[model samples]
Target: MVQHSYAVGMFPATLISLKVKPMNNQEHDEAVLHRLLFQINMEIADQTPKERELFSNSSSHFIGPPQRIAEDNIRLGLMIVLFLAGTPLNVTAMMRLRRSMLSSATPLKQLKQHLNISDLMILLIYTSSQIVWLITVDWRSNDLMCKLLKFSHALCFSVSSNVIVCIAIHRFSMVFGKSTKRVTTVSLWVAWTLAVATSLPQFAVWTVYRPYETATWQQCVSIWFVREYDIRTKNKTLLAEPLISSTAYSVYHVLIVFWIPAALLIICYLRLAMVVSKEIYCECECVKQSQSTPLTNGNMPSTDQHVTSSRRLLSRIISFSSSSSGRFEKALMRHQCVTMRRKRNAIRTCLLLIVAYIFCWLPYNAFFLWGLIDHDSYQQWHNTSIAFLRYLIVVNSVTNPFIYLPNFRSALCSSHAVQS
Candidate 1:
């Protein structure tokens, strides 16, 4: 793999060299490679059939494996499990939350107005693409299905990334109390429109018919990525000829999901934390003052008395906040401001989701980058390692949704109980 990586055509060198910045990450990459190799070696007890052929009959001058197909099945099966487990929870939660917000007749009625129907549609389409691609037949062997699959794949992948970016930006605006209306409107339209636009190149560049040896059938692929080297390379990236939009899609993901958006997430969260912390502190101080002041007696108040006094003060303050009376009006304005900030706490949550995506998918992206570069290194035995790594990475996606379930247990329980 290293040897082929040094040579011209494989995906790694292009990926590696394409970067403008010299990586401080090489050591990490090397360590990761070692771990992957060790895992692969442990999994495969024999010389792989694919490696054996590539070293022997293959003109590509590769080593090991007659086929990595079985290894792929194992890896993909695990991914499918993790992915399926995740979808129901994360998507359902988002869907339900949005629905709840929209249906509410409560004070947070603003939430309904902000829930863009287009963005919701985009999210659903993206989720659908994931599930659809998982269940569909291997389209690589057939012309029509190949194009359709590739197109939908690109649509799902790109739109999801874009939507995430939009969501993050929207939340950022909300958190800072900026012009959320503009951000929301822009992001909503861009998310769906670009989603449709991104799918076009996938259809355009796809040949629809793939070259397969007599031994090959319409079985699912060993590589989930046979991405093109350049969008215009007109050749295979690793093992597959992806659409012309492939390079663009990869670049967008790397930037939005990994680099640019990640930095923005950190910044937004820092700002949000500062804002929320200040608000909490102010409220805490006011409440403390109210609690500390005795009835001119400085005597300790009974617990119930303290609670009643606090509730009464809170109610009076809340009511005063709606008033236009001179001195009380200023207090009212402050209260309204704080109340608005609380509603915007949802923005902080959006940034956190960005953080979550970074943590969850970073390994998978790194693996893809490294493996594609080292495709030559990916002998029959190497496939086992790649498979194992892929399984672990995909597991993140599944675990993400379930991991948060515990946090929302009360809500889930209430929803279930209500239904029951």
Candidate 2:
């Protein structure tokens, strides 16, 4: 029987590096040999032995395995596609939003402009960094680059999440008839402040280091994982601290970056939908009342009666401005039609954004939490699923610009038509 070793994907823990030779081709099938090799490799990888004699320098050098290099190439191609696709969309969105700002200058428009800016930042910072990182696949830089890159990743997530929440809040206020000028300005400032503050912890957690002194491979990873491996043989029972800390940080990160923002978006959009639906129902009822003709004895009104009713209705409409309160009501009604249309469009656009956000991020965040729950099983399956989840996240950034851009342009055209 021939012996073979297969290195599966990116993570070291998923490496199937052990040579597997079946006892006899007839006695043990290829399936059994592969399964047996997988089990043995997984166990050895988990040990993370510190002794230089345990793992050879060639295998320890963190060079991309055939499978991992292939994956990196695929990832690099996809990143380029995303970057190429997203850059123009975001840039066009920014230009249109800027023009809209000059034309109308609403707070809600300002919030959307900023949201697009944040998405662009994510596309440029996170996606670009990912492309470079995949190309190298090994840490060719110092510790500062490692920490800075991690920090940039965290910063992108936080900023994007917070800006989305801010958009939801601004839209909510707009539909509810609240003044959003000061609110929007303050909320934007707070969003950036919170994002920076939350991401600062990454500087302390990540660093570039080799797995072993004799190993040629260097990686930028959480120090906790490094320390866990370094002291693994010293006290096996003391392993819980680093794992606990890492899990805690993961929980905090997910909450701030995804869970909390998701909750806020759901609540805000649901309330906005309810309020807009109620207003639409009420408007329809008013229109039905106004259009219905008066009837006598369940028969159609005569011409004289119809003429009288028309005269009375016209007189009432004309007299609507007689009092100060009546004038205010007339003024409000004059703008109600336009306001209602604007509100409906806002709700629709925001709903699309919310749906895109949930669809793209739900699995990613779920997998992140699952990894914290079952590290071993997560490591086993993450090699296959992680790339897809990350792609979904990048796709969200690409889709965001398209989501709002068309809606904004249509609204702008409608406004121009109304003016004309």
Tens digits of per-residue lDDT for model 2, 1-420: 333333231111122222333344234243422221111110111122211122223222242322234556777798889999888778878888898888899887787888888888878877787676667665678899877777777777678788888888888887777779988999999999998898788788777666556656676656664664454323233545665565566567778878999999999988888988998789756645533632223342335545765877655544543444445545655566676787788888888888998898788667655654565566567556766765787788888876876665576457669999
Against the true structure, whose lDDT is highest?
2
Candidate 1 wrongly placed segments (more than 4 Å): 1-68, 90-95, 98-102, 105-141, 179-182, 195-199, 209-253, 282-348, 368-407, 410-420
Off by over 4 Å in 2: 1-68, 212-217, 232-237, 293-336, 372-380, 407-420
Q: What tens digits encode model 1's per-residue C-alpha lDDT throughout 1-420?
A: 121211111111112111111135323232122211111110111122222232232222222323444543444465456546555655655665556666763322222222223223323443343334334323325656555654554454444455556666655576577787676667767765776675565454444222234344232221212232221123222322332234444445345334564565567667766776776667667645544552232232335455765877755654554342335535655785677566455644554556656665465456555544564444333333433442442343444433322256577668879999
TM-score: which candidate is best? Answer: 2
| Per-prediction TM-score to the true structure, in the order listed | 0.53, 0.72
**Candidate 2's TM-score:** 0.72
Candidate 2 global CA lDDT score: 0.64
Query: What clash pairs does model 2 have?
Result: none
Clashes of 1: 15
What is residue 219's positional error in candidate 2, in angstroms?
2.5
